[model samples]
Target: MFPSSRLRRQRKAISFPAGWQIIPIAGKYWTSGAADGLGGWRWTGNLEANFDDFTKWGVGQPDSDMVKQRVALNFQSLAAVFWESEDDTMSMRYICEVEDSGTPTSPQPTVTTTTPTTTTPTTTPPPVNECNARKALFIVLESSSHVGSANFQLGKQFAADLSRAFTGLSTSKLGFLTYALIYHVRVHLHNSDSPEEIVSDILSAAYEGHSTRNTAEGMLAAKLQLETYSSGNPMHMVVLTNGVSASPSTTKHIADLANLVGIRTYAIGVSMPDSADQELLNIAGQYSDRVFKTDWARLDTILGSVVNKVCNS
Candidate 1:
């Protein structure tokens, strides 16, 4: 659903079949909760998009009070306006244009197989143990406009999968919440539920808000929760975000503080590689092995990595 500005402009110039009156535009303008940086009528979103070129806007359009909405083009008016729906999703007919409109090429995993020579008998080394089963895990998710309803729900499912993966492990505990302008406790700390119960709670969690993201506040809140239930276990956190945080300085400070306190963090930056925040590496600490980034649509694929690293680091 996330298209680029160049593609949107192309669609605007192209001809569509009948009944395709409304189309979702490339960028999203997040002005829902509070006026963070939305300068009245000025557009602000998707740094890669050409929002500065505003020749396609409707007359006095984009005046919506909501902050977490995206843009849609009106074929009849030849203008673009903010689109919203009752289910918090794009309800209009959409144009699906393939970026690579040819035969697709997917990456294949490389495999290496070698036959062992019987010249000398070698003893196999003992399997190295990396699992830190008794770790307390906290996952802080972003529920801002940066992550729309679809992706936000997908994120919850991703968390649920990760939490469930740790189930049956001797000493794994999971705590989770969403942080926008403020954080909400979807699943509280010290919840002595089985792994299955924790996963159920996460899967059923709802989006708290579409406000601006407060990453620092989320990290701080997670730190407090982890402290309460840590019980001397190795602590870990998986924080997922789709955009730059509302408080970068504060987030960095708190991340540093958490690191000093022996809390290992796994930063999951979900967005296009170029658009995603590179600060995630810093947040994940010196071990780059724990940092991860993925397109918003592909966030679920990283759920396994998050669960494995947090539970077995």
Candidate 2:
């Protein structure tokens, strides 16, 4: 059967020759979304080399609206570019350069040489430790009608102990925010400054009573002071309340603030029971690594422990 017709199946595949190379579209800023549509374009080895070259190109001038986007090697030496396919892909291109020999009277010889150097990426370290690091301590003193001067003295002593423990650590700063019936917050610069002066200033501030303790306002003030003074340094707050507030919502607000700002709240109950709702303490401990409970007898020890943990950590 040399049949009327013969049928043969053929498959065609596109491939590049041995020395043939892919030349990525030049200067076509492709966006990330459109990079996928680019077909048959392959990225060769050592992409960083291309990145270095692009970064050296620098940025363009702004428009009439004074708005401009710049391209440069960041601190990490990472490069960013938009591709032509409107695709933003981390890619670069290659160009083959040819040298021409002009009007050779005699026979001209061509020399080809290739030297590959091993490139080790350079890394930058973080900023050096500064002498101005500050730690904040929010002391909330809440005393009931039955509370005596001795209990207030105990609060002052606890604050003093805390100050002493943290003072030795860094040449930084310390800030005090006291909230009871009213708000009392102050920033203390401890760099070459005396702790006694700071304590005296704290003690001299007038005390205001609102007939109801605003623990929430106290915590908010703490957070605000931490943001204003500490500059994101670690904060430790000690709340000395003998009784629960007449306004329960304020306590809840305090808890929410502590949760939000990651401030450690250590609650000191003078004669109050531990079974009482310690939302502030719980929230503080959740943000920080330590939580403490103390009565009149073990007050100093508890304060010391909290200070040590905060400063050392």
* lDDT of candidates 1 onward, in order: 0.61, 0.44
lDDT of 1 at 236: 85
Put down candidate 2 lDDT per residue, 1-313, tens digits, no spaces: 0011110111122234567675533253321110001111111111111222221222431111111111212121224432222111134332221223332233348899956433221132122232233566556565434345455555655665566545544544566655554344543332344766555555444344335455554555555445445556676666666666545554555555664666666666566665654554543544434555567655665654565565555
Question: Which regions of candidate 2 deviate over 4 angstroms?
Answer: 1-134, 143-146, 169-171, 186-193, 205-210, 280-289
Query: How many residue pairs collide in each prediction?
Result: 3, 15
Our model 1 lands, by Cα RMSD against the true structure, at 14.5
lDDT of 1 by residue, 1-313 (tens): 2334555765555554556565544544322121122232222232223344443445655444332223454443324444331111334454343334444344458999966422211133122333447677888988887788778777877776666555556666678988886566667667788776786677666676655677766776677667667778788888988877765665776787788888998888887365444568656764678888887777766665666667666
Candidate of highest lDDT: 1
- What lDDT does model 2 reach? 0.44
Worst 10 residues of 1 by lDDT: 118-127
Work out how many backbone clashes candidate 1 has: 3
List the pairs of residues colliding in candidate 1.
Answer: 31-67, 32-66, 32-67
